[model samples]
Target: MRWAPPGFGGKRRSPEEIKREGWREQKVLVVSETDPRLTWPERELVRQLGDKLYGYRKEARHGRLDP
Candidate 1:
C-alpha cells in the first residue's frame, strides 16, 4: 500500500508518511450504544455492520479481496 523513495531503506512507512502521500483515507464515525436514540438491537446491528464493512474495505484496499 506504500512505496519508499529510491536509496531509502528502513522500517515500514509511518501513518504520517501515508497521510502525506495522499493514499486512500477514510474517516470512521463513532456511535456509542449508550446513545438514547438507538435501541440495544439497533446498536448491535450497526456495530456488526460497521465491523464487516471495515474488514471488506481494508481487504479491498490491499488488493486481497476475492472476485
Candidate 2:
C-alpha cells in the first residue's frame, strides 16, 4: 500500500512489487519461540514430529523433564 496523496492514491501493490522494496535478495528468516505463524498446539505438533524424526531434547531425556 502507498500513501494517499493529492494526485496519487494508495493502491495495493503486487507481491513482487512489495518484495522488490526490501526482499530483492534471498534472506534468512529466523523462527523463534515467539513466532506467530502457528498456534500453541501446532507448535507442539511440530516439536513432537521433530522428536520422532530426530530425538528428544536434553531436557526430555530418559523420560525426565529436568533442565
Candidate 3:
C-alpha cells in the first residue's frame, strides 16, 4: 500500500494509513519467567537479558521481596 504524506487528513481510525516519517517505535516484551509455555532456557535467557539491561533486581539487591 502507498503511504500518504504526513499531514492533517482529519482523524483516521487506523493510524497505519499515514506515513510516519522518522518515527521509530520503542518496544517492550512482557513475559512471566514462570510461564508454563516457556522452556527453562527461554526463561533463563529472558532473566539474563533483564538483568543485563536493568542491573540486579531490587529484590536481590536488598535481600527482600520487591512486591
- Tell me how candidate 2 scores on lDDT: 0.61
Q: Alpha carbon lDDT of residue 13, candidate 2?
A: 81
Instruction: Using lDDT, give the best candidate's number.
Output: 3
Instruction: Return whichever of 2 and 3 wins on TM-score.
Output: 3
- On TM-score, the stronger of 1 and 2 is 2
Worst 10 residues of 2 by lDDT: 26-35
Query: Each candidate: what lDDT?
Result: 0.62, 0.61, 0.63
Please state the error at residue 47 of candidate 2 in Å: 0.5
Runs with alpha carbons beyond 4 Å of true place in candidate 1:
1-34, 56-67
lDDT string, candidate 3, 35-63, tens digits: 78899999998877777777777665677
Runs of candidate 2 exceeding 4 Å displacement: 1-34, 62-67
Between candidates 1 and 3, the one scoring higher on TM-score is 3
C-alpha lDDT of residue 9 in model 1: 71
After superposing candidate 3 on the true structure, give the runs of residues whose Cα lies further than 4 Å from its correct spot. 1-27, 61-67
Residues 13-47 of candidate 2: C-alpha lDDT, one tens digit per residue: 87556555545455622233335778998778777
Residue 34 local lDDT, model 1: 55
| Model 1: per-residue Cα lDDT at residue 24 | 41
